[model samples]
Target: MYRYTDFDTAFVAERNRQFRQQVRRRISGALTEDEFKPLRLMNGLYLQLHAYMLRVAIPYGTLNSAQMDQLALLAETWDKGYGHFTTRQNIQYNWPKLGDVPDMLDALAEVGLHAIQTSGNTIRNVTADHFAGGAADEIADPRPVAELLRQWSTDHPEFQFLPRKFKIAVTGSANDRAVIKAHDIGIQVVERDGQIGYRVLVGGGLGRTPMIGKELADFVPQADLLPYVEAVVSVWNLLGRRDNKYKARIKITVHEHGLDEIRALVESRFAETRAAFGGHDVALFEEIAAQFAPPAFRNAPTEVYDAAYATDPVFRAWADTNLSAHRIDGYAIAQISLKAHGETPGDASADQMRVMADIARRYGHDELRISHEQNVVLPHVHKSDLPAIHKILKANGLATANIGRISDIIACPGMDYCALATARSIPIAQEIATRFDELKIENDIGELKIKISGCINACGHHHVGHIGILGLDRAGVENYQITLGGDATETAALGERTGPGFSADDIVPAIERIVEAYLEHRSGREESFLETYRRLGMAPFKLALYGEETAKKARAA
Candidate 1:
């Protein structure tokens, strides 16, 4: 984890001071609601349907025990008893009083966390693979580059207000766990010849218009990554639409203008961006990279882990689902599920946060991670410590063995909290999880991702789920639409919609029908839901969902 330097600390402190004054002015009636809107948004505060929401950045999803403890404190003190972890690997407090936000900001600043650029039309949090340093297949840790980008972008004079909000995700592994292809700017760390460089992608987004990123630069040397990224953003910043907010995204810009033209513009801009940095940014990157050096790992016997796995069925299930391969011999990366069967997808109670912090301190290498899938990760847990960690998590209601399963859904804070939402995403996600759990077939069904969004904004990343659910207001009633075969992995693809929208009452049954269809037609359990969907196409699923009559009628038409 990157520790905040004196300058970083001082900058955050100053920002907090300024925001404190801004909050006071709004409370004192010196600033009206309209006047306070942009100011509050710049600080990552949103006026939701019910209350004010505060989003705090977790840089590259890495944090220590102290930082996790601070998050728990914010949840316990300023907001509700729980915090919602988002797809961007950030956390949102849905019920914060307007006046207490500055205090919350100050508390976050103490832990080197802030909410800047989280909501505005600027470069949002620079995200990376949650298992960056720990993944077995990584070429290099992407967090150093992510941190460099974060430092460069935060409060940068040139990019504070772009035509639309931008996002960037980086991954060092060949497997795309970070969903980099769906970001405004996606960076993949690749080995070329003998050197590590970046493979840059641009124009990927997942709102009303979902797109997989195209290669902006096939290979950019590490030394030139910062300037090259700036060039791409700089080109889009000027070329992107400003008239209608709907078409303001860089995705739309790329759609309107050909990639060749965009490349030319970026190349022209890169010359200037490259020169301005000189060599200071590279030095800064090297400094930031050093801060992210892998923690000291221990060589330990895995007999305890093996023994526990053989003896305890509960531990076995959790371990099988939650653990990932770590780069170190004796270490494993463990994901703590926030999506318990009937609970909100990403909400973690303050006590749960503290429990995770304690486990990270005592078992993990004093480092904890928040996954983009809305789970906490102990990225460097030794195998011998698995049982004890599992026991503690089990006691705290964080030991759900449903990672990548149907019940382990990714849902946004929809109508329940978000003012922009049309229908309730939480209840839909809850119903689906509970129904699948009761059936007890989710484990047997194999890996599946079910993402739900309340609206077309795709906050839940429904566009990339194996079974994607999009909730909308049909006329005056709540309706849900289903999409099939979407993937967020290396072979990224947007889901295809299945005919008409279903009523809220019909959505769960529709999902069940699709799952049944997948089970019936799959080559074997070896083939996942996504594989079945892609292999058989939408025909079988559609027949199962809408029945033979509608399917035949549609096909004939």
Candidate 2:
């Protein structure tokens, strides 16, 4: 958790003050909705279908108890009783009145959080591995670099109004929990001959045109990272398509121009940018890095955890599914699931947020993290505290042991809150999760990532999911399409469509057929859905989904 310095605090205060005036002008009719659009977007406010949605950036997904409490307070005071955690690791309050937005921003500023750069066509929140600091296999924590990028891009005049919105994700682990390959800029912190550097990837994104980022630089030394990143963005800023918003992203730019040409342009630009840096950015990175020093870990026996694991099947199930290895002995990372069986995927009530905040402060080193999977992470919990933490989480409806399962879905706000959505997505996600829970075979099925988006925008990251669901309006009815075998990992690949779309009524059954097909065709129970899909390919699943007659048609097409 990086504490805000006096400068940081002052900077946020000034921004909030400015936004407050902007908000008043809009409310007072000094500015119309069209005039207020960009101003509101710059401040992370969106005029949704029903009401204004305020998206607050949880930079690098890091938070302390106080910040979490402030989020809960915002949910309780201004909007509905719950807040939606997004795939970007940001939080959205979907029911705020236009006039109360400034007060909400002030409340967020008090906790060192803000809504800046969340909605605009700018570098969005710089996300990182939720388990950054204490992951078992991390080379280094990626949050420091994420924070550095946040400071670099927040209001960078040169890069703010790019051709389209840009996103950057970082990961220090070899396992790719941050989905770096699916970002506009993916940074992997790697060590080369004991010298820390970055492996930079560019042009990776998920939308109408999904792409896995290409390797822009194999090893950029720590000192050269900022300039190199800037050069890449600068090159794309000038080269990208501006006439059509659909093709404006850097991914399309890379596709239009070969990676080699992009690399050459970036390198050429890098030379000038690197010289301009003159070691200042490196110095600043070092100062920023110090703020992210790991919390002092305490050594203790895990007798309580051992006892609970042996005695309570309930606790054991949660521990097995929700817990991950921590770097330190006797410590573990606990993932709190917001996707309860029949509930919304990422909506957390204010009380539940408070409970998590309390648990983090009590037994998790006073630090909490929001994962891009729409879950919360207790990144530094001692094993000895697992039982008590699980007990607390269970009482608050946060103890769902379905992490990485079929029910642990990633879904966008869709038609329920997003005006851009063509059809509803939340109901589809809820139905799928509920149906699978009814089946009681999720544990048997193994790791599955089902992502759903209401449209082609891919906000839910459906392009990277094992079972990707896209909801669209077909003629006048809601239709859902499916893509199989897509991955968002070190070996990232986009899923392929499984033929004709299904009606909303048939979507769940189609998914069930796909799962059944996976179960029957897999080499063994251990063979996951993704592995089975890879081995058997789309032929069998399409046959299962569309049946023999339609399968022939799909294959022919």
Candidate 3:
């Protein structure tokens, strides 16, 4: 909810002007594609398979009605009629023409949004918990620190060109909705003896080398937060690999050099960096925190919500799945499901965006959030407004009633749009979702996360899904690999891979076999898939995937 300051306004305007000129140069052939590539990337314009894609950052995934309306405009005017919400809490326009990117950037700037640092090997967008201030369990809101980090890293001279792109996420709650463990730098807001500080984690990432972050600092005081983070990034910037693009991430740096050594270096750097700040950042954080104060709560009766739950099956199902507890009594956080049955996961048409924006304005305190799970969040909807909101959401095709369920899949725009992808991810996700819908037993399955990535980049966060599916190219055919027992929560762990990859045609049936095994093996509905996997291990799931005969043969051998 932080508004752009005069400096922010002028800075974005100037950046847009520079990018406009760059676009003109590229179109006029003054700059070749090779020469223009970096420039366009810095502006969040990517040369995708068919056209240029523009990724617009929704910092900490916070947006107002006006901003959402502007995004809908962009979707309608420039690109295709829909926009894809990504795992990074950004929106991607897949069909923007190269010539029209400047105008798009200017449009975004008008709404106090930008594409700066959304791409390139610099610090990318700073993300936080989608339910930051509204979550009932939060110790303190993490967005103030997230905003501070954003301001610090945006165009920071020393970090403008790192060996690899850097990512940072923050969360105020213990539930870990932000997937902090899988980020380059993860900050958890913690209160120790009446003082709010941060529990910092470093070296956590997915992709080729998946790792759960190690604790960098158990407790960094609020005053020392910025400097401490800078020291960590500075050390990685100095030590991270530059020779191999694949291994250039900070996670690799931490993997090679022990955490103890990295901590020592960061501490040594922090001493100097801390002294230089001289409490300026502390004052700045206080100002930023003031901007994120919770909105006024309405004292309303929940009788309508209770009555609807009691009478309407459709509304009850949706309420059961999509609603989360809010910090304010009599209020709830409504998650708008982008993964509606067979639709492309995380995609919202222009009309859908407008509907969500309108709902937020009318009932959700004029605040909206884009969850890392690729869904829109009306973070502070009153319980009394549940029925009305649900009605509108149903009309807009945004009410899927599948939050945290089997069909609420997270998928990247794989070979369909990404040039780096070896196999398609969206179609696979669509097929699985459709199959699950046909089975009509998703509710019985319970709290399952199916994440898919086209390649090892792990953009879909497959590494931490309850059922992780990674798609790869095997001799010109798409082969999908499955991993089980992955959990992205306070107790974070990477999933173990199941033996042998399945062909694209067989992947859904393989998943069905695993689910059926879970249904048979579970201790009633009380035991979830993840819990069953944890207690029973991957043996049963493996047996289901490869058949009991194969398991017996392997045991005999």
Candidate 4:
């Protein structure tokens, strides 16, 4: 993890000091809620449905054991005893009081974490692959680049107040675990000939105008990344619409103005930005590269793990599903599913956080990572220790083993928490997960991503889910819309709307119907839900999900 430099430390301390005074003024009745809104948002404080929600940034989803412990302390002392981990890998406290936020911010700052840029229309947290350095398929780790972006965007005067919030995601792995396509700017680390570079994707986003980013540059050398990224943001900042909040995102700009036009503008801006840099900022890249050096790995036996798995069905199930491929031999990346059956999708209680911290310290080289899917990653856990770790996780309700399965859902804090949500999403996700667990079809169905967004903002990346569910408020009633054929991977494609939306009560059964339809229509047991959906199209699933009349109308073509 990148330690905050003295400059970084001083800057954060100053911000916290300023916020403390501002908070005092607000509480003393010198500033109204309207007057304090922007300041609170700048500091990542949100006045939510009930109380204020404070979102703290976990840069690039990376954290140390100490940082994890600090978060647990915050959850226990400041607000609720739990924190909701967001899809962006940040954590949110739903019950922080207005007056106590400065203290919370101070506490976060003490641990090299801050809420700055976690909210508002400014550049949000720069996310990357949770298993960046540890992933087997990565050409180069993307964490350094993400850190570089974080530094550049943090309190940058030029790009701070854009039309809307901007997000950037980087991934070095061949698998698109970061869901880069759903970000405003996505960077894929790739190798060209013998040198590593970035394949820059611009204008990709999910909100109202969902768009898959276009490849802006085929191979931007690592040295030129900062200048190039600045140019892209600058272009969007100047040209992106501000009058309409709906059209403020880069995705809308890309859609309204052609990709070719956006590329040309970015290139023109890049030329000017490059001249200004004169290769000075490139050294920061080197400094950042040094910060992200991989942990040393040791060879170990898999015999103990095998023996335990052979005996414990829980350990076997968790190991089979929760573990992912690690770059180092004899190591595995352990993804602890926050989306356990009937729980909030991405919430971890204080005790659970402590347990994870303990596990990371004991077995995972004293490091932890938060994945974009709202799961925790023990990025460097040895395969030999899988059984013991599984035992710990199982006792703590963290060993559900539904990673990428039907029940491993990514859901927003819908109406239950989010003031912007039209209908509830977490409960729907919970019901679906619980229903699937009851049916015992999760592992059998295999690798299905079911993302749910409360509204069309698509915060949950529902548009790209294998089985996308969008919740909406229809005439004082909650309704769910299902989309099929969506994918979030190297071969990314947006899922199409299946047919009419289902009632809130009808959604779980509808999802069950879709899964059953896939089971019947699939070519074989080897065929996954997404594969079958793509091969046969949405006709059969639509027929099963909706009634015959709607199915007939949908399949008419």
In model 1, which range of ten residues has the least summed lDDT? 548-557
Q: Give TM per candidate.
A: 0.99, 0.99, 0.99, 0.98
lDDT of 2 at 286: 91
Rate residue 24 of model 4 by lDDT.
Answer: 93
Per-candidate RMSD, Å: 0.9, 1.0, 1.0, 1.1
Q: Write the per-residue lDDT of candidate 1 for residues 391-452, one digit (tens) a residue.
A: 99889899999999999999999999999999999999999999999999988898999999
Model 1 misplacement above 4 A: 553-557
Global CA lDDT of candidate 1, please?
0.92
Cα miss at 25, model 3 (Å)? 0.5
- Shift of residue 48 alpha carbon in model 1, Å: 0.4
Candidate 2: give the clashing pairs.
none
Q: Per-residue CA lDDT of candidate 2, range 1-557, in tens?
A: 68788998998899989989988999899999999999999999998999999999999999999999999999999988999999899999999998899999999999899999998889999999999999999999999999999999989999879999999999997789999999999999999999999999998999888999999898999999999999999998999899999999999999999999999999999999999989899889999999988899999999999999999999999998999999899999999999999899999999999999999999988999999999999999999999999989888899999999999999999998899999889999999999999999999998999999999899999999999999999888999899999999999999999888999899999999999999999999889999998887888898998779877876677
lDDT of 1 at 120: 90
Per-residue lDDT of 1-557 in model 4, one digit per residue for the tens?
Answer: 79999999999999999999999999999999999999999999999899899999999999999899999999999987999999898999999988899999989988899999999999999999998899999899899999999998999999889999999999997788888877889999989889888989887877666778788888999888889999999999998899999988998888888889999998999999999989887888898899888887898788897788798887888888888888887889999989879999999999999999999999999899998889999999998888888888889999888898988899999999888999899999999999989998788898889999998888898999999999998899999999888887778888899878999988999999888888888888889988898888877887787668877887787
Error of 4 at 240 (Å): 0.8
Can you list the residue pairs that collide in candidate 4?
none
